[model samples]
Target: RDNADNTYTESGTRKRMGRKGIGKLAALSVAERVKVISVRDGDKSGCILSLNISNKNADGKYEIPAIPDDQINFLKIDETKSGSAIIMENSRYSINKTIDSAKRNISLIFPFACQTFKIHLENLTTGATATIDDTTMDIVKLSDALLTFSDEDSEYNEYLNALHGAFDNGRYYRVLQEKLPPDQLPAQKVLHKALTTIKEKMLLVTITGEQKAFDLSICGWIATFASSSDKKRNTDFPVNHISIIANDKLGQFDILPDISTDRMGEAYVVGQFFVDLLEETELPDIAASNRQGYKEDDPRFEKTLELIRKNALRPILELKADATKEKNYIRDLEKANKAKESKEAFDRSIREVVEHPDFKKVIHDSQPVKQALETAWELKDTLKDTYKKIMISHSSDDKPVIDELERVLHFCGFEKEEILYSSSNYYESGFEAYTDIYDYLKNFFVNTTRKTDLCVIYILNQGFVEKWDPVLEAGAGWVLNSTWYPMYTDTFSSVRRPFPGTAYTPKLNFDMDEKQSRTLAGAIYRISQHAGKLEQTEETIFQFIKTTRLYHG
Candidate 1:
C-alpha cells in the first residue's frame, strides 16, 4: 500500500511498535519471493507488485526488476477503502502448517493482540474459518488440554472415574481394584497420587509493587511443585525460572542463577514477572536485537532483579523448607503406626502358639519340662548383672531433677531395667512408711549386692541431708564402698556436709533456664559415660563439654 512505505524506512521520529527498520526482512527470511497487492482511497484502480527475494546476481545483489505501468495489471477498487495484502512464496523457514498449531503459537506470542484486534483466519482449501479472541487463550482451556489423556476410549474414562471416586471417598485401594485391561492402571494411579501430593504441597505467592526508579508497576505470582516429576508433567516450561515479560511478551525466560545457587530450591520454583516499563519509549532501550533478553547492565534490569530476590526468592526458600518438614513429619507418623501394628501382630501370634493344645501336651512331658526349667535359670543368670548396673539415689523432693537425669541416661543409650530408683520399686514393696530408715537402706544395698558392683548417682540437695531416709541411703553407699558421683543443687550449698572427705561435686542450680538445663543434661551425659553406663566417642564428649561450659560462663 502507498501508506505502507513507512515500514521500509530507515528511521522515524514518531513512537512505533517496532524500532528496527529491518522487520521487512522477516518476509525474505521465510520465503524466496514476496508479492504485494494494494488499494488506496480516491484511487480509481488497484495495483500489484512483486519482489524476487531469492534472485541474486554475480555481484551478490538481489535482481529486482522494475515493471512499467503497462506491465502492471489494474482492477476496479472501492473508492472509500484502503488496504494491503502480502503473500509469501517458496518459504525457506519451518512453520507450523496446521490450523491448531498456528493458532496456539499466535495465542502464546501475542495474547493481548488476539483480544484487541479483529483477527480472522481461514483455510483456503477447506473453506473453514476460525475466530481467535481472549477466550481462545484462557488458562482454563490450557488446563483442560493438559488433563486430557491420550486415549479417548472407555478405558481412560474408567481411569478418570476411579480417580474421582478415590478423591471423593478417600479410598485409594478401591480405585486400585478397578484396574485397566492392559495393566496401565497402576502407573496411572501412581501419577494420580503424585499429582495429589503436589497439590497438597504446592505454595503460591503474589508480589505487587511500584518501582519508582524505573517508574514501573510490577506484579507476579510464583508457585512451587511438590516434586520434579509433578513439575515436569504440569509444564514444558523451564524449571526454576523467573520469566520477565514486557508488553505481554517474554523478554527473558530465566533469571534463576542471578537469584541463587541453591539447586535443590531451584527445581520447585517457576514464575513470571510483568513489567511494562521495559517497553516504554521514554526509557533507554535495553531489549536485545532478537527480543529474547535484556541488557545485563541496564539500571532497570538491576532494580527488577533486586525486587525479585527480596519479594520472591526469599519466601520461596522458606516455604520449601516448611513443606519438606511437614512431609517428613507425616512420613514418620506413618512409620510409627506401622511399627505399632507389627508389634501387636507379633504378640498375638506368640499367645496363639502358647495356647495351642499340642503346646500344652509338650509342656507336660518330662523332657520338655526339664528343658524349660533349665532355660529359665539361664535367662535369670544372664540378666542378673544387667539389672544392677546403675543405682539412682535422691530425696523425693528432687524428683524433677532426677526425672530429667533419667531421661538423659536413656538418651545416652541406657535401658529402663538397668536403672534402679527408690520411687519406682521401694513404695510398691511397702517400704515408703517403714519405721526404721536404716533397715530399708541395709536391705536395699546389702541384700541386693547393688552397692559393690553398681555405680551410685546421688542427687544432693538440702532435703537429702535434712531427711533421715536420704542420709541413711548415703550411709549405705559408704558401707558398700560404691563409686559415688554427687550432683549438687543450690540447696546443698547451705546444708552441713554429709561426708567428711572434701571432693568437688558437679553443681546445678535449681529452677534452671533453658541454657542451664542443657548444661545439666550435658553434665549427666558425661558422668554416665565416665561410669561405663554409656559409650564414649570423641565427638560426643566434645559436644558435652561445650554444653557444660554454658552455665559456667
Candidate 2:
C-alpha cells in the first residue's frame, strides 16, 4: 500500500489493487468544504467533483447548485482522466483553513494525509498543504466519494425562510428583517422565518467550532440559526457531527432529537447546544441565557421555561421598545432644566476628588498615568456604567514578561480591551515611546472599570522589589491598585525569554500574600465576571491586594 510499483501486467506474482472506501471517508471527513478529483490508470481524462457540508446547511438539504461561470475564481476541473490524480488548494476556499498559529495542530490530526502528499501547513494566518500519491486523485472521483444523498432538510430552508413572528421578530422583527445591513449573512428571510415554524422542519446545522475567533458577520449566522427556529415535534438540531465537534453535550450518543418517549429531549438538545458553543465562542452567553434562561436541567428555572414557551416574537419586540423608550425619557429629563444643577453637582464631585491630597498622589504617572486619565474622562462622559475598565500595573522593563501574561489571559477567556495595557498609546506628548504613567490614576476617580474590568499586575525579577520607581509608585497608588489585582511573573507580560547564555531564569517579584491559581482565577477569572452587573470601584483604592514575593530561587 505504500507504493504503486505493482500496477502492471503480472508476469508471475505481481498484482494491482484499488483504494478502499475508508480512505475516501478519511478524505471526506475534513472540517470544512472539501472537493475531490481522481484519474484511474489507463484513462485519458478525469473529472472534478465538489461535495461539501456547511453550517449554513446543517439541516442537510442543500448541495453545490453549480457555480455560475462568472463566480468561478480559482478552479478548473478536468473530467477526462481515470487513474485518480486530484489537486487541493487550501487557499481562499476557506478562511479557517488558511494557516496561522495552529499549524502543528492540523498536521498532527492529518499526518498520514500530510506525509503522503508531502504537504506542509505553514503559518496559521495564511498557509496550506498539497498531497501527491502514486494513485491519481482527480475531481470527479473525489466528489463522488464525498457526496451523500440526504433528504432530511428538505423543508429546512423553506421553513426557515418564513420564521418571522411575535416572539423572535416581534412587530419590528419583520421590518428589521428586511433591513439587515448590506454586509450581513445570506438568506435573511429564511433564517428569520424559521423562528416560529411549528412543523420542526429545521436540521443539519453546524457551529464551526471557531465561532470564538471569527468576525461578527460570521457569528451573526450562528445567532440567527439558534434564534428563529421553532422547536419541531420532529427535532432539535444536535451540536455534534459538525466539522468542529467541540460541543460538550448532546450528540448522537445520549438521545435523538425525535425520540417520542422523552418530552424534555428538546430542552436538553437546545440547552446543550448553547453550553457547547459557550465553551469558547465569543457569543453573548449571558444575554442569550437570560432571554431563554435554559440550562442543565434545573427545576428552579420553571419561570424561565414559562417565558420560553410563551415567546413568539412580538412580545420580545414590545419589551425591547419599552426599555429603549424608558432609557430615552430618563435622558431627556436629565437634559432639561435639571441639567445645570446636575452638572454643578458632578463638577463638584470631580473637584472634591481631584483636589484631595489622597487622590493627587494616587494619580500621576509619566506613562500609564495619562492614558488612565483619558479613559477615566471618557467613562465619566458616558456615565451609563459606574466603573470604566480594569487597569493593569507593570513596569516598562517587564514588557516581554507582561506580553506573555497577556497571552495567558486571552487564552483563558479574557479580552485585551477588558484589561488596560499600560504600555499602549496613552500619552501623546514627550512620552511618545513612553505613554504617561499618571493617566490611569486620573481616570480612576470617574469610573475605574466602566470601559473594562479585572485589573491585573505583572511582576519581574528585581524589577519592582529592586526599587524600580514605576512599580513602586504603582504599588502605592490609590486608583491603579484599587481593587482585586491578580499578579503574574514578568515573563507573563514580557516578550523576551532566556537570552543566549543565560540561566533561563524567569521569575516575578511582589508581595508574599498571593494565593493559588484557582483561588485567583475565581476572584478574577475574566472581564465578563464584572461587566454590566456591578461597578469596578466597589473596592477601596487603599485595599491590600494579595500578591506573591518571587526570586530566581
Q: How many residue-pair clashes does candidate 2 contain?
A: 110
Residue-wise lDDT of candidate 2 within 1-553, one digit each (tens)? 2123433235633222221223443334443334443434433332233354332366776544343433333233343433333444343323443343234333322222212345444443443543332111111111101111112343223212221122232323344345555454222222121222212211212233332232110000011112123222122223211111122111112212222111211221221111122222222222122221223343212222232223322222223223233334334334543745765687799868866887767766555875787675666775432222445566666665455445434333343444566664333111224445455344443444323333434344435545554454355433443443434453344323221212322233333233333233343333335543222221210021211122111
RMSD vs true structure, all candidates: 17.6, 24.5
Best prediction by lDDT? 1
- Residues 374-458 of candidate 1 have per-residue lDDT tens digits of 6644543443222355677778876655655554464454555557666653343223454465554554565445324367777
Q: Predicted candidate 1: what Cα RMSD to the true structure? A: 17.6
TM-score of 1: 0.39
Consecutive 10-residue window with the lowest summed lDDT within model 2? 215-224
Runs in model 2 with CA error above 4 Å?
1-239, 242-388, 407-415, 424-435, 443-461, 467-469, 479-481, 490-520, 526-553
How big is the positional error of residue 310 in model 2, measured in Å on the Cα after superposition?
Answer: 44
Alpha-carbon RMSD, candidate 2: 24.5
